[model samples]
Target chain A: MVEYKDGADFLSPDPIETQVLQGSQDSEGVELMVKKNNDRLTGWVSYTLSRSMVLINGLYEEQKVNGGVPYPSNFDRPHSFNLVANYRISRRLSFSSNIVYSTGRPVTLPVAAYYAEGRPFLLYSARNAYRIPDYFRIDLSVNLEGNLKFKKVAHSFWMLNVYNLTGRSNAYSVFYEVEDGAINGYQLSVFARPIITLSWNFKFGNYNSN
Target chain B: MNIQHTYKYTVTKLFPGGVRPKMHLWVVLIIALAVNSCIEPYFADIGDEPELISIEGSIIKGLSRQEIVISRTTSLGNPVFEPVKGCLVSVMDELNNEFVFDETYNGIYTLEIDQSSLVEGRNYKMVVVTPGGAHYESEYEILESSVPVDSVYYDIEPSLDPVNGIEADGLQFYVDLLAPDTVSRYFRWKITETYEYTSAGPIHYYYMDLSFEPVVPDDIWGLYRCWKTDELEDIFLTSTLNLATNEKKQIPLNYVSTLNDRLKIRYSLLVHQYALDEEAYNYFMQNKIATEGSGGLYTRQPQQPITNIYNVDDASERVLGYFWTSEMTSRRIFVSKLPELDVKDYFYPLEIFNMEDHGAGPFPMAIMEEDGVRITGSPICFDCTRRGGTTERPDFWE
Candidate 1:
């Protein structure tokens, strides 16, 4: 039995006055996993399909929000899949990689405009009415081990990582502005390029065995 | 399910196969850099915003004619309005005296009220019946006594925005109110500006009507002088509710930069002052913050204003506005010259024309002059009325 809940709802585009509204939250999900382990290679592929929804309306006044109706929460990403693989080429060198993809977060937007008494105003939809762009990225890493000597006191390895190998410009936010008598939107993203990092790690007990 | 065995390793119980992520997977997670997108700005593509009704109006104590504007919102980024017509609107007093409003124009309703019936201390409310038969009403508001304006004037000062570190000299207008009564004294100002402008001179050349070529004299062409009035939209509010003495002095009203033509010549600024209670004062301040912000809530989160108006049948229906009642007192001031400020010169493109330039058969022609520069071109350069101005001077003009 699903139970109702209580939260704040802001539907009008001014002051952002939070009104007490009643609603319910529900979520359902499915997961799939594939793991391959052997002497030469070890990798895992995990996929998930999930739905997160929130329904909020004032029972007395019928205030439509949290979203006017059922809506996705800020962190509701319906489809997420992650792939990881590590291939041992030689006793000293190995290659590891990953591919990650998921839906973006929900964002609120003003879809219309009006002017009263010569002062311009905007009209907004339900809270978190739309979403940003989906996110996709791939990464690659290489591990090189030092010469193996069991009698030695310590051992070391060099790890090289290349992030966002595809250079996909994932959108963090979408903002609107009126220019030249038209509404123009621009997407803001924190990282749109590839990044590489290298680190030399060591262990005292020669525990770097893969 | 072997619960007892898996319970020993509680962390692995979350997954179906109890597959724990290995250490190599954690080492591959490295991300985030300075993002760069080569895409240009695009018109936002999204669903439509719901159409809502907007209403605004007020009734003054001594004013005879009161008007209300009812309109609907348009598409995104397009502020052009669509009038909501065929609605019944009226105001009812506590004494049961109902003053009806008729749609004189598109979405504009007006009423001619008997000034005597607008008695102070009477409670008044507005009732609107939409075309869909939905009824709405505003909470009753008592007509408070208007506080008299002691003085209205302007001073030359530098525009200082300390936050942005900006400084520039401009004209700043202010108002002073008389001492408040024992009750709270809250005030808001509506500034109406009327200015007098002139044509280049008289009728330069009359080639239109072939009769009585140049019948009117240069100074008496009825086009030499005209007046235009405009109601500014900036909301200004002040109150003495939380003060020790409850006095208002030099309350800043409106600021005018020297770049515009508002103070170029003879100008009048009429301050329509409304005395409201603390509740209504707070409501108007909310709108003031919203109306003055960038994009008016478009860039920010949505917030519902706590208004006094509500639906009669359904509490869910939201009508966007406040139907206010107050005793309004107004004061007018004239500004003819600002010798201390350098105003930008007006640019008028005037060209020379003659009857021989088109058809040679016109009888007489008159040349118009401005600062001894004589030229004849379009009627706009010769008649102030060609622009949106009236030849009849306002009766209140000094």
Candidate 2:
């Protein structure tokens, strides 16, 4: 189905309130997936390719963002891959894992510099001309059940999970800042380290409720 | 086996304390994860921007020493302006008559054209042959007949200082164009403002022969009164196309705050009005929108100003600036400080020292005293040359 949306906020660093640009985005993509659900190794692999762009013709001459040219949307990522798997080790023990990879998102960056009125001013590249590093992460978890009988009055289980198992530092965004009369670029990562968690679950039901 | 009985037994044992505390912790963790967004510095190399030739000039009827400025755009990061020197520049009309320009200053070429040569409706264009053998030319521009300015006047208005949010008294200068019969014309204005000011204090006596004693000069010269002239920088344009009549009334040309020293004594403004063609008007209108417009949410996209001049060999090569010819008229007006205005509060008296207080007995010092203290002013007050203008009155001054 085709849909129409408007009033998307395009934020710029020049000024907060007045620099907010209005634009619409159009995104199109194709997704493919394969699954094996009935085997010992039950998993699904999915991949998607997409492109999204925005055109913001500013109301005033100064408000025009990126010279009124169409720019890649901030959330645009052309490629994404996901792999999820579950393996049954025993009647009481099972393991699950997930792997995800995606192309980096677009970002605006400064590419040149010039001096005006005795001050250094940066000339920026086209909006969203550069992208952050590609993103990749893996997660694994183990589940253990106290009992697996057909009929039981109550059941208990435990889960041990590890997120970002490889501890990859994927940049969430890239920004340019002026310090000491010079412009510098920096990368920021949201989840830069691995995380582990342990949890317990309990269930109570008769044979008919199973 | 009853399902209700089994669920009721497990529920009673599952929560020994309560689920509230655990749920609170989970909520905190989720919030922490949600706010973990970050930003960092990014650098990208976009290569160098091409340098282009810049030409700026205009031909006006009844004006002498017509000049053109030639310069080259420097690389990004360079603040110094690079002038295009040693170039052959000339202006030609449709009749094949030419006015050759001589490089009077670096990147500035001047030509003295006979007033008779500049006809009201003649078409003219400028040509420049650079040192690097690149040929450039401007499209032929027709000289449009100009309407004389009816008058130039000023009005007192309240204006806000952009830097400080203070409402202050200001002078708004305006120009009125004589009404035409039926033809609508585009108008461009250039202003030259001259004002008189004095230094903080005038020095009448000087320490003579290192004796610590002061000597009064034999005669007081042009040291106290100074005059300064400045050309307005901003673009000013108006059109009578949409007006009911072919007349534009009281269009604002510039503004000067009452706090400005230019209003201390006397100020004179000379406004030159030029008749512009439609294309020239559009070019300047676009330029006005680009340079004067502020950037933000409501800003118009910035684009390189389109120019009429182009490279003869390579059409795609970029050239900067504009060339046009027009007939012009001007009017001058003088403004004096209005009486009954509280001038004492805004004008600070210049500091003067007394030689008698230094125990120099019976020394002659120029004295202008308040509260019975003999005052001697600084050299800047006594020397008009330090103010960057001449003491000779302008020939056109009334």
Isolated chain A TM-score, each model: 0.80, 0.79
lDDT of each: 0.72, 0.71
Instruction: Report the C-alpha displacement of residue B196, candidate 1, in angstroms.
Output: 2.1
Candidate 1 residue pairs in backbone clash: A12-B303, A14-B303, A16-B303, A192-B35, B204-B366
**Model 2 stretches with alpha carbons more than 4 Å out:** A1-210, B1-43, B179-184, B207-211, B215-221, B294-298, B340-390
TM-scores for all candidates: the values are: 0.69, 0.69
CA error at residue B285 for candidate 2, angstroms: 1.9
The DockQ scores of all candidates, in the order shown, are 0.21, 0.17
Give the Cα-based TM-score of candidate 1 against the true structure: 0.69
Model 1 chain B worst lDDT window (10 residues): B24-33
Model 1, C-alpha of A68: deviation from truth (Å): 16
Best lDDT goes to which candidate? 1
